[model samples]
Target: MEAETVSKKWEGKVSAGLPIPTTAAQVWPFLEDFCNLHKWLPSVDTCYQVDGISGQPGMIRYCAATITASSTSSGRDETMIKWAKEKLLTIDPIKRCLSYEVLDNNVGLKSYVATMIVLPIDGDGIHGCKIEWSFVSDPIEGWRLEDWVSFLEPSLQSMAKNIQDALLLL
Candidate 1:
C-alpha cells in the first residue's frame, strides 16, 4: 500500500493596491464572504472560510496560485489565513478610517495588520472613495516588504476594483 503524503511549505510575501469608487460599506460584504474570494481576486484558484459560523474570529481564509510580479515562480501557491473583526479596531464611518489584520497570505506574512483608510473624494458629480491599505506584517517568512506587496496587492486590489464595478451595475 502507498503511504499518504502531505507537505507544508511557507514562502515570502508581496503587496499592492488600487483605487476604487465605492464606500467601505459597499465593499465590505465582498470582503467578508470568504467563498466569494475567487470572484474578485484574480490569482486565487481556491479559498474557503475555516469557521463558517457567523461573527467568528480566527476564521481562516486561504488561497492558492498566487505568483510573482516578474511572472516568475509558476504554480506558486499563496494563502491568506484570516479573521473577521468588527469594532475591535478603529472603524469610524464619519472618519472613514479603520485598522485591522486580514491575516496571511497577505503581504507574505503569517499575519498582516492593515490600517486601511477610506477617504471620500469628490468628483464632478459624485462622491468617490479612495482606499489606502498600509500595514505591517510578520517578518518570519523570509520575504522582503517589496516581495510581500508583490504576493498580495494584485489580487486584493483587483477584487476591490471589481467590487466597485459590480456596484455600478446596481
Candidate 2:
C-alpha cells in the first residue's frame, strides 16, 4: 500500500460593515473600478493597472500604501511604502458586489481573497446603505484572528468615510 500525504492551509475569515448615508446605486460606481481603490482607501497611496482590463477578471493591479510604523531609535516617526499585486476575481454590478485576490504583497499574507458589497438598508427615509468588506486568507504566521479583524476595521471605516465624502463632492 502507498502512503498518502495530506496538506492543510489554515484559513482566517473576517468582515466589517460601515453604514453609509447613501444608496447602493450611488456607491456601485466607485466600487466597480478594480484599480481605483486608492481613491477610497486612505492608506493606499496609489493604484495602477498592471495587466488586463478594468472590471475584468484576471486584471492585475499594483497598489502601494504608505504605512507609518512606531518611532525608531532616533525618535523620528518611521514610514514605509509597500505595494501589492492583486487580481480581480469577480464583479456583479447588479448586485453591487466585487471581489479580488492578492497575488503578491509586501506584507506577506498568503492566498488572500477579499470581497466588498454595498447593501441597501432602510434608514428612515434616508437613502443609505451598508458597505460590507470581508476577506479570507491564510492566517498571519504570528498573529491571531482578532488581530486581522483589528487591522481591517480601520481600513473599512476609512473607505466608508471617503466614499461618502466623495459622493458629497460630486
Candidate 3:
C-alpha cells in the first residue's frame, strides 16, 4: 500500500488515573521505561533501538506507533527512522513528573515540549495518580494543522484509554 505522508505540529497528552496500592515511586519505573512504550501505548506495535542513547538527549529509536481504521490502501505504521529526539528536561521520580522536547531535524518537530505530571488525586489511601500532558509543535512540510489534529486526537484518546486500561488490568 502507498503511504500518505503525515506532517504536523502537534501538542497533546493522554493520561489516566492509575490505581496504586503503595507509593507513587513504585509505579515510576513502568512509566519511565522508554522501551516499554508499546505496553502503555496501544497504537505502538513495536519499539527498538536505532542508534545513540535512549530516554536521553541524542537518543535514536524507531517506534511502530500507527493505527488505521482498516488494513487497506491507506494506513499508518511507524517508520524505521534514525532517532527520536526526546531530551529529558527534568524527571522528578518522587513527584512522577517528566519534561521533554523534540526538534524538527531529529524527530521532525519545529518546536515541541511535552510534560507529564503525576500526582495523587484523592486521599483514599489506596493511592490515586493523575497525569497531565502538555505540548506544542510546528507543522511539517507535508503535514497540516487540521489533519495533524485529526490524526493525533484519536491516537491520543486511545492512548489515554490504553494507559488507564493497563492500570486496571495490571
Candidate 4:
C-alpha cells in the first residue's frame, strides 16, 4: 500500500496598506471594536457579535453583505445576502494589532486568517497613520491571487476613507 500525501502550501496571500490623515490613536478605536465592521467597511451591510465578548480573543462576529442582483426572468431586482463568521484569534491593544480567522462563510474562502495593524506615521510634521492588512488562505474556487489583491486593496482604501471621514466629523 502507498502512503497518501498532503500538500501544506498556502494558496493565496495578500497584503495592503492605506494611509489615513489621522493618528493611530484615532484609527485604533474603530478597529478595536470587533463587531463594528459595518460602520467603516462599505461592503459590510451589517456586523454583530455572535459569540463571546466583543474585543476579546475567541469573540465571533457575523458579517453580512447584501447585494442587489438582477432577475432577468422576473424583470426585477432581487436581494442576495452573503455572510461570514469570523473569530478573534488575538488582540494586542498596546501593539495596535489584531488577528482573526474565518470560522464559517458563504463565500468560497477556506482556511482564511488575517491580521490588521495600525502604525503611526509622520509626514512633514503631519501626524498620520497607516493601516496594514494582510491575509493568507487556502485557494478559493474561481479566485486567483490577483483577485484577492484587487478586492482587498479597494476595500482597505474605502475603509480608510470612511474612518477618516468619521474622525473628521468628530
Candidate 5:
C-alpha cells in the first residue's frame, strides 16, 4: 500500500498596509507583545499565550474572534465565533517585523503564515508609521482570495485606528 502525501503549500496571498499616526517606536511596542492582538483587532474578543514565552520564537497564542452579521430574514443578528492557535515563527526587533504560522484553526485556514511589519514614515514632517500585514494560506472553503483581502483591509484599518486611540489615551 502507498502512503498518501499531504501538501502544505500556501495557495492564497493577501496583504495590506495601514497608516498610523504614531511612530514605529510606539507601534512596535504593541505588536511585539505577541499576545495582545485583542487590544487592536476589533473582531478578536480574547487572545492569550497558550505556550512558551511571549515575544519569543516557538511561542503559541490562542485567539477567539467573533463576527456578527445582521439577518434580514430572521430579524436578528447572528454571531459566529472562530478559534485559532498560532505559533510564532520569527521575530526581528531591528526591522520591526514578526512572522507567525497557524498551527491549528477552526476557520479552515491551512498552512497559514503571516508577517507584520512596522515601517517608519519619514520626510514631509510626517512622524507617523505604517503597519504592513501580509499572509499566505491554503484555499479556504467558500472564500475567495479577494474576499480575504477585502476582509483584512478593513480589519487592519480598524486596528490602526485602535492603536492611535490607545496612544492618545497615554
Candidate 6:
C-alpha cells in the first residue's frame, strides 16, 4: 500500500520596508555576509556559516537569538534562547537581493522564507537607498500577520539605522 503525504499551507505574509540613508553600495557591504547578521541586527545573538560557501546558494547558516522574558506576554518569568538553521536559496549582489528559507527552528512557525532587497531612491550617496524585507510563513495557531510584523520591525528598523551610521563613518 502507498502512503499519503500532507502539506501545510501558508497562513500569513508580512512585508515591511525601511529607507536607509545610504547608497546601495554602502548597504550591500553590510548585508552581503550571511554570517554577519549579528553585527547589524540587534536581535541576533550570533550567526555562523554552517555549510557550503558564504553568499552562495545552498550555503547554510545557524542563527541564535535571545527572547527576553519581559518581551513575551505569556507571563513567563524566564528568558528563552531560540535558534534556527537556514539555507541560502538565492543571492544577487548586482541587484542587492537575497533569499533564504528556514530548514529548522525552535520557533513555532512550521514554514518560513524571507527575502531582502535594496533599491535606489532619489537622493545622493548618504541618502539614496531603501531596504525592503518580505516574509511568508505558515504560522502556528494564535499568531497573526500583525504579530509577525511587530516581531520583525524593530530589528529591521535597527538594521537600517546601523547601516546608515556605519556608512557615515566611512
Please list the C-alpha lDDT of all candidates, in the order they appear. Answer: 0.52, 0.79, 0.58, 0.83, 0.83, 0.77
lDDT of 6 at 128: 68
Candidate 1 residue runs with Cα over 4 Å from true position: 1-21, 66-108, 115-119, 122-126, 140-142
Q: Is candidate 1 or candidate 4 better by lDDT?
A: 4
Query: What TM-score does candidate 3 reach?
Result: 0.57
lDDT of 4 by residue, 54-148 (tens): 78999999999998989999999999899999999999998889999999998887899999888876533155777788887876778777787
Per-prediction TM-score = 0.52, 0.83, 0.57, 0.85, 0.82, 0.81
Model 6 lDDT, residue 41, Cα: 89
Candidate 2, 57-122: lDDT as tens digits: 889999998888788688887989889999989999988898898999888778888888877766
**Tens digit of lDDT per residue, candidate 5, span 122-166?**
633166778888887876778877788788888888888888788
> Can you tell me which runs of candidate 3 are displaced by over 4 Å?
1-14, 19-23, 51-58, 66-85, 104-108, 123-127, 139-170
Clashes of each: 17, 0, 2, 0, 0, 0
lDDT of 5 at 105: 88
Model 5 ranges with Cα > 4 A deviation: 1-21, 69-78, 123-127
Cand. 2 TM to true fold:
0.83
For candidate 5, the lDDT comes to 0.83
lDDT assessment of candidate 1: 0.52
- lDDT of candidate 4 vs native? 0.83
lDDT tens per residue, model 6, 36-120: 8999888899999999987889999999998866636666677788999999999998888898899998887667888887777
Error of 5 at 58 (Å): 0.5
Q: Considering only N, C-alpha and C atoms within 3 Å, which residue pairs clash in candidate 6?
A: none
